[model samples]
Target: MDQFILTFLKNASEKNFQQLTGRFLPHYFTLISKVGGMISPETLTSIQKALQEGRLADIVSKIQEVITAAENAVLEVAVIGESGTGKSSFINALRGLSHTAEEAADVGVVETTMHKTPYQHPKYPKVTFWDLPGTGTPNFLPDTYLDKVGFEYYDFFIIISSSRFTLNDARLAQKIKDSGKKFYFVRTKVDSDLYNEEKTKPTTFKEDRVLQQIRDYCLANLSDIGVSEPRIFLISNFDLDRFDFPKLEETLLKEVPCHKRHMFALLLPNISDASIEIKRSFLQEKIWLEALRSAALAFIPCMTFLMGFDLPQQEQCLKGYRSYFGLDDKSIEEIAEKLDTPVQDIKGHLKCLDFWSLVKDDSIVAKSINCVEAFCAVNGGPSSSVVQGFKAYILRSKFLNVVADDAKHLLREIETVNIA
Candidate 1:
């Protein structure tokens, strides 16, 4: 297979190679040019070997494999704080679940989490949020907290506090830093504080001023305890869209490794317009890679035996987009239930063609195949089997855009309901 790929590249003109490589290997090119310093030695070696051997197909396959592995990778986020700081509620919010949801972390005014408990995201199970036991409790003292909770296992930590950042929080942050792990200070229950302030001083109270005061207080506390330049995010567990939660989400996406950033963006709760837009852009960037993978798979000799290959792959990719954007029937039903609105009302907002129906439509399939044949004819007519892959790529790319637009429209509808 490698020999065949090498021979094919050798026969192709340099201009053709450049055009094809630009189309199919855009992600690889971006990674090499933008993140060259951060690429792992093993990954660099694999890419260099593919280039040296002129195995275009293998390179595409390897790139797709790397992306798939990253998508399936486990992301462990630890939520640690003093007891009654709303860590459990924050975890639930982050996972897009109500505190009453079956898999939600237990929330209480008292210390509920006695031990480190991992709660998997309802939609993306590969992403787990660990609710670590309270830091200042006698059972889990600040001094030995990191070792007790197995700190190394977590990709990052969120050290939360209800009021002021305490000495225990500062110590934990320092410890996490010393261990070379990232930690963010989260000031939770800001809604309760704001409510109290509004009630006490309704005439003079300003939400922005109150929020700034809270932030400054938290910063002062952390600074007094010798924690330098602490990154503090203020949030309300009940309202993730308010205050600093969006900025926190952006920071996490930027700070994590490149592959993991994609997972974070994809799995983020579809609460705010900004979040929905981010998800759309991340998935959009991924379409080229998916198309290239489809094209490469089409070139495989044995792929013809696998039920013609292209249709099934296209179906799977479309299904993934549906699942990711919460466009499927189950997701829509859940949203309707949560908003106390009719399921049809929510579904009405969707502007995309029904992907599931299209997958089963014989006419659409025939039209797609014909379109592929026409495309091949314009390029001097490639083999029918090979053309099927190109058809799959084009079809998937078209639907991907449709699903993304539908997701945006759905988000607007939800926002309208929220406003009302």
Candidate 2:
């Protein structure tokens, strides 16, 4: 793909540019992002015109604006449910924190969550989860629920239940919807449900059948409170890879406004292969702009780490890859504890790290792109910005893929029969 992109850039004919623009036509129905932060026909045309008019400064300013806004974007998620519905546990799991982790939310008995408590993802503090007091709590009048919980402060609400949806849950949903907000209904502790079914009816047990029954029950319960076409995600906070957790995460990504999606996607813990791919694609989208910025820099995060770039900065970039992909030492320890598996067992899955020396100092990537200089410059001499940006992009792209693949491998390794 890098070779093809470089080749296309070297000889960008009208036909090729048209094809490129066609590929990036704006996606209006879903997320929106800064002009050059993502691919769209407008971005392509703007860049083309800028190059033709020699307005490099204008393009650079736009890139800076987009990257800055993306870095500062914030998302506030609220998780609300009756006490013991596993609300705190769900927040812990979502943040990829183990129960024993100091930052984890406090687990409760029947009605323990007394107020709206905020929990931040250890790595991405900007993405916060509020463990909201349940609407069913006896202390609050039903009509005053939304105001009392500061509903307007939340970007989205997740209403969870261990068994079935309750009247209070429905009321909260209605209020959120009427007030112009989004909410999701999650049925937690599904691992227990499946285990019970398997244990008691081993002879007749079918995972699909059992899951359908639970879904049917939740649908019926929510419908009773006037929820139309309720979409209830069945999940076990302890085992997010199974059941509808992936679906829930994907749905949220689609619904989150385009500007905030980058942070939201980056902060997702590696739960499934699908999620790893999502992060990869999101990162992949920025490579072109980042490369441009890097070339401009001599400039620029994903745009970090030049072949002769600063070593300390390179180390920090590698640490970021490890942490973002959930392979950092701390995250690995937490994952091992969560799965009740030996830390070595988790590390064993990352066999790629043993034989893949190029990942450390991929001079080969630099060699493959002998044309990087040619592609970056056209007027006369090779532009340092173009050369540095190309090198930065290829190097960053390689590491991103490597980290994502390792994450998928580690997730699969830990999710064996022992996890339940």
Candidate 3:
């Protein structure tokens, strides 16, 4: 938890450095970095001897190289919808920005976003949200939208709408589908209407059923447009928790392919344990590859240094890696603001799995940790009797993975074959 440790971890993660230095390197380097400015010449000389003799130099060098690559990596997402479906607001929400007219501008809803308006998420600018004008303007043809937006550039499409789907929305969706890209239907602004309906509820018993009814309504509407068994997400850009934003995310995660989904998880507004796990897994995938490649690069047969540092670094680098992958505080708050799910509920979802326990300090230490202790720490942790039920309903759910595979298959075809 020391500031330097945090800084070191952040820098290393951003750089994609995944070597484990072990009992010797972490403590030695951390101490050195802390005292490097004031250390005596003799002391510095001794440390250098230890580093060279112990063979830490090569490990450090490789770590630096991979870290730099991760920092330079860019993942871009394309936002598509007919004009005025709150694409801009959705982008702002995803990026953790306020909803001022100038800040979250869409085409018909505000001033038309003349070209592709790129919005950077506050946390990761390397990942972008590109907002294109509605493909459904009065005289605009469906193909024109694809031409203007350059459909091939985006990793995926986020189709947005505040109300009913229009011809433009359908056209764009079809194009994306035909082109073999992934798209999600985001129903924004459910908070205002839901709240109004709650205010005028005829019976308290009907509240739960009301939500289900709304979902059914949306699905039926999509079905009318030939979207068979349509899975529509009821979301509110203003209140994330209150609406079906979680379901929306689940849907998106399910449909997005693994290759890009990893990055998608990285860009998500981290709120729950599942989100944290998916994000960590995504980042870890890259680091794993980086580390593996670095080890391969150090394949010089006569290099004595490789023997001392390479193996240890590779084995231990993933230690404390999990903490680096979870949603940071800002992302969680942004998600909380939009979902209207009490930040506590989001925290509660994570806390349920002894997430804090599994996450040692701020880093991912192991694949799995004892959640029982975390549960005990938090008021006996969901009575032992219900643990199985909890896992079945929540933690172990395979819903997200199922959707991701479907989307991944779709994208593989598109990415491999260029459709004119």
Candidate 4:
């Protein structure tokens, strides 16, 4: 299955393949690195031939196999730091679970992760977050810590702190780097610092000044310990919108392997409009593939009878999309409570989809479907049978855009009002 994916992607430029997959083709490594090595010559020729001939069913099963392999790729993230640095909280936040949630990392006065512990995201089970035991203890030595924790297991590491950066953090980071792995430095609990400053200094305290002071303090602390340049993030675990959490998320998304990027993007908690768009684009990839699968049913009478119209599938996709984007009613209600804003204000941002009216000739969904038909008509992509492939594609695209727009609008409102 993995080799077949590499073969198809290598041949994606073939006319018939381009017509069916559209322009949203993702960027990925030329070879499946984990699966390893170039596909055999015979497999490549067969895939290219099937695509060139536009024999949809011939390649469709292979298409299904390759998509499954890509979607199920395993990813591991390690969160490492000293005790009381909010590493557990960061892990919980990254996984989008409350501290009190059953599967959440243990958050308390006593350290619970005495050894490395793994937490699988409820939605994206393949992407696991490891809460590593605290470093810099009497028993903790930088040289041996990596081995003790089985460092080779993680794709990347995030080293965290809540106060002035320490020599231990620097030493551990250097070790991780020397081992040929990526590591990020994170300073947590910025909200607590800001609140204390504002309360104690009352009249003269400026939020910007305090934030800069904290930032400079971390930089200077790390620089003094021989870290020439540190990729550091200031984040408040309790308040993701308060600091550099979004930046951290963005950096991680870009740094992870390309095949894992789509899953990583979808799993990101919606804290900024940029992150929301990342999720939107990743979700669109899924929609396109679903459209192809749905279109395939149009040709297969048995499957068509079993799974009627693309309508139900579209509805189901949007339902999951809304939950992921925090645009759903429950998610909006939670945000509304946090912001002290009326639920209606946030909910109003969502563009309603009138499914009944969509079947009518004059409706927006109908109009969009017609546009796709016109596209197929003019292009004459192979033949009319191939044209039928794009019908579901356009329908899913419209619904997805509505969800993306709504999410961005809601995020803008939240940011404008200041979630701080």
Q: Give the TM-score comparing model 1 with the true structure, all chains together.
A: 0.82
How far out, in Å, is residue 29 in model 2? 14
By summed lDDT, the worst window of 10 consecutive residues in model 3 runs over 363-372
lDDT of 3 at 418: 33
Model 2: how far is 34 from its true place, Å?
19
Off by over 4 Å in 2: 1-58, 294-308, 335-365, 416-420
Instruction: Show the colliding residue pairs in model 4.
Output: none
User: For residues 1-420, what per-residue lDDT tens digits would candidate 1 score against the true structure?
Assistant: 112222222333231444444332344444222212223457646755664555656856676666776677789999998889999999998887777778889988777988889999887888999998887687767778899889899999999999887888888899999999999999998999999999999999999999999999998999999999989999998888888999899888877876676777877777676776677666655654554444444445465412244556667777788887778777888889978999988777675546566566455456546655543544454566544443454566567668877887887777788889
Candidate 1 C-alpha error for residue 110, in Å: 2.8
Looking at model 4, report the run of 10 residues with the lowest lDDT sum. 31-40
Better of 1 and 2 by lDDT: 1
| lDDT, ranked from best to worst | 1, 2, 4, 3
* Whole-model lDDT per candidate: 0.72, 0.71, 0.50, 0.68
Estimate candidate 2's alpha-carbon lDDT, on a 0 to 1 scale. Answer: 0.71
TM-score of each: 0.82, 0.83, 0.53, 0.73
**lDDT of residue 81 for candidate 4:** 87
Instruction: At residue 1, give the lDDT of candidate 3.
Output: 17
Global fold similarity of model 2 (TM-score) = 0.83
Model 4 misplaced stretches (Cα beyond 4 Å) = 1-70, 285-309, 327-388, 408-420
Ranking by TM-score: 2, 1, 4, 3
